[model samples]
Target: MASRDEVECWLTDMDGVLVHENHALPGAAALLQQWQDQGKPFLVLTNNSIFTPRDLSARLRSSGLDVPEEFIWTSALATADFLKSQVPGGSAFVIGEAGITTALHEAGFIMTETDPDYVVVGETRNYSFEAITKAIRLIVNGARFIVTNPDATGPSADGPLPATGAIAALITKATGKEPYVVGKPNPMMFRSAMNRIGAHSENTAMIGDRMDTDIVAGIEAGLHTILVLTGISDQAEIERYPFRPDEILQGVHELVENDPFLAEIND
Candidate 1:
């Protein structure tokens, strides 16, 4: 594994590393500012593709963080790329937010409200019984299934909420069909993000909270991984997990403090 000093680009997960339930974790913003000031390259990679990079950028800035659309890479974007490979210019049934849908449309996939060539699932929004039935029928009628991520639930300021993976699971159970998932813990998303930045895993380090999806994916992608204890997976959980991170941090803000000049280093 390469040393932290050797890492040229850093990729981080947003929810656990930067905030919890909309509340900026201790030092999250400062850490981001610190990196920016130091000129340390970093990008925020997220599974939530409901919002466009621009939309998410505005939201992050509103929440007291300074982020730009260019610094964001979302699963929705990755899913769109995946769909492009599978069915370019083909019709699709997408169940997600504007970010995912807009990307799909831009990729030349037709978004249909009725029977379609393919069905894609992401974070659920206003899913009614009728919508479920329509999705089921389409799948039954030979529509291919594609899930953005398999996260069962996501962390929020309030607490945890059912994520798109949960909704995708419901559809899979109802239709007895499986969907191809493309998100963290899956190198497809990582590869896409790397491709976007033109950064190789050898020069990039993935810093995130969860071991399963975040760190595991980093390892599989041949990138260095750092486990942040700011969110889901705790210290004990890390010991039990098969994949291990190259380094551990309390949070993004703490990461800022870890600079040798900012904080004293000891043996």
Candidate 2:
């Protein structure tokens, strides 16, 4: 692991590392407070674009981790930022949860349930034919395809379930179009986060539970990576995979406790 003094930013995973199942994971709050005490920067970053930053902040606060709205970032927001600069008027044919729509709308995009200039897909607990058909129509009519993260599934309290990939696959099958993803493993998404932290990739370390998206994305962006065993990835999975993380931790709490001689913090 890199020395603490060398660290500039700690990019984090929200669901697995900072929280689990709507509850704050043990050590998460303290670790965050530790960062705050040091006046160091961090973020609650996640591929699950199911809540707006304000909504997510409230959720986290209710769950016992009181963080500010600006401290939380999601794939939905990044996707919105990406589309704002690329797609004029930011009109979209979206197949995602309410958060995605909210971010798109907040970004001055005209969100539509039907005919659109782009088809942006994200996680939705309920997948339906009508939903797929709408996206299919957009793609067939030459609408640009964008996806919030390509995770094939999501983490359940038990594990993972059929995810955004499955939905994208259904849409792709219907229209023979593949969507451009704007989450982890996508450098643009990482760049967006770096922009938020005002840090360079060389000084940032992404801590997450998933290897394919989080770790891979960090590596691709030239950022250091830390994989924890608390979420989707396990020791067995790490051993089985060709990709490797720069460091590994059992969970978020262990991360803070393992650091040598906690530095005197300012904030």
- What's the CA RMSD for each of the models? 2.8, 4.1
For model 2, how does the per-residue alpha-carbon lDDT over 37-112 read when each residue is reduced to its tens digit?
Answer: 8887888897888778888899899999998999888999999988888875868878888879988988899977
Cα-based lDDT at residue 191, candidate 2: 87
lDDT for 233 (candidate 2): 91
Report the Cα lDDT for candidate 1. 0.83
State in Å the error of residue 49, model 2: 1.4
Lowest-scoring 10 consecutive residues by lDDT in candidate 1?
258-267
| TM-scores for every candidate against the unseen true structure | 0.89, 0.88
After superposition, which runs of candidate 2 have C-alpha atoms over 4 Å from their true positions?
1-4, 113-115, 156-160, 257-267
* Candidate 1 residue runs with Cα over 4 Å from true position: 34-41, 155-160, 257-267
Once model 1 is optimally superposed onto the true structure by TM-score, how far is the C-alpha of residue 57 displaced, in angstroms?
1.2
